[model samples]
Target: MPITTNGIHHEERGSGDRTIVLLPGFGCSIACWAEIAPLLDGYRTILMDLPGHAGSVGAHADGDLPTLAETVYDACREIGLTRFIVAGLSLGGAISMRIALDHPDEVEAVLGIMPWNAGGTSAGDPVIEGFNAAYGDIETITAGITSISNDPTKTTDLLHTMPTVTEKMWRGWLGGGAFTSMADKLPGLRVPAFYLVGGKDFVVNQAKQIDDVRSIPGGRLVLHADLGHLACYEEPELVAREMLNFLDTHAIAPA
Candidate 1:
């Protein structure tokens, strides 16, 4: 059953004492977890729709990233998620960083997947450009499709998601200081964190992500070979496997 807490819509699945919260990237719906949810075995999974996206569209706000994370924490508390792991992609990743940083005791681990700094308004901003292209109009949207993936078959799935996106979602990501700028706080994240990136993610600087994670104490970084920004979307099987591996090492306390 779907539940709402603090205006955030989320659903839980799987079965285990430990929980894993899955957060989608920018402009994505809660369905973003469709590919990976079933694969996460032995843990209760919370599939959440970020504020201002999909079912939670009404929850859009002008607050900064930490504020958003606080709202997420409120939802977790309401749902009885006292202790859990967080896995996020892109914009979700930045929010996850804030959550873990603020509540290291409650967040057992953090799985940051292709999470980049969601702050900037430069004309050359690839992320903003991609969004504008996808939602701006017909010609740009068509041109933006192939930029996400090389596979023709996979392109169709991403294309279908464009309509669900909104102007609020755009502001939350591209607007200045929408997120608390995870880039500088990388080294301060005390929770066990796993940073996953792809070789082909053009929007985010992959090298910087790797360097940021390494600077954190015992932070682990993995690069998905031949993949792009949406690794969770493009390679769910590998993402699930890698996520489980990270959970085993960090989330599950050693006996």
Candidate 2:
């Protein structure tokens, strides 16, 4: 069932004490975390759609990363999560970082999958141009994302939701208009941070991600050479195990 969080669409599951909030990548729904959510066996889980995608499609317009973060924060508060961990992929990863940065006291830990270093910076030109060219046409945009994805067929639903994604979302989220340099923020991070970088994710710079990890007091980076951008999709079980262990290590109690 779809519930509202300050009018935002979200879903909740699990019955554990500590909660894990899962935010998906572009055009993704709570379904994006299906394979991994179960691995988080003993914790409460909340999965959400960003403003312009999935269940929350078109709920808000002209929103920036921080704006989206606030929406999610409001949702979390409504869901009654006093102490929780946040994890995301791509766009979600960027938002997770924002959440951790802005509310250090609330977010217990963070896990990012190909997350961007959110501030006044963007990825390479090729990736930016690709989205710009396919902005209005759903077919074109879906095809573009499918081409880079590790498993195109698995992401069909995400592709279908592409049409709802707005140009502002494209420019601000994917096209890289939103940013806050992590170089200066990581050292000051209050939680444990982990990044999983795909070897073939051409959109993000692996080197910079590693550097971001180095800055954190105890951040760690895991690289998978055979994987592409949606690495979690390619080997969800493996990634889930890793995610579970990382959380367990940092978690006050085992989930």
Candidate 1 lDDT tens digits, 158-224: 5555556566556555654432455566677778988888888876777667777876788888887
Predicted model with the maximum lDDT: 2
- Residues 1-255, candidate 2, lDDT per residue (tens digit)? 575645567777776877899988765677778877877888888888877776776466344777888888888888778778999987788889889988988999998987765433554456657776777877778778778788887767666667777667766665544444546777888888888888888767777788788888888788878667776566788778778878777555534
lDDT of 2: 0.75
Among the numbered candidates, top TM-score falls to 2
Q: Which regions of candidate 2 are displaced past 4 Å?
A: 61-63, 119-124, 175-182
Give the runs in model 1 whose Cα sits over 4 Å from its true position: 1-5, 117-123, 130-139, 155-157, 178-180
lDDT of each: 0.73, 0.75
TM-score of each: 0.88, 0.90
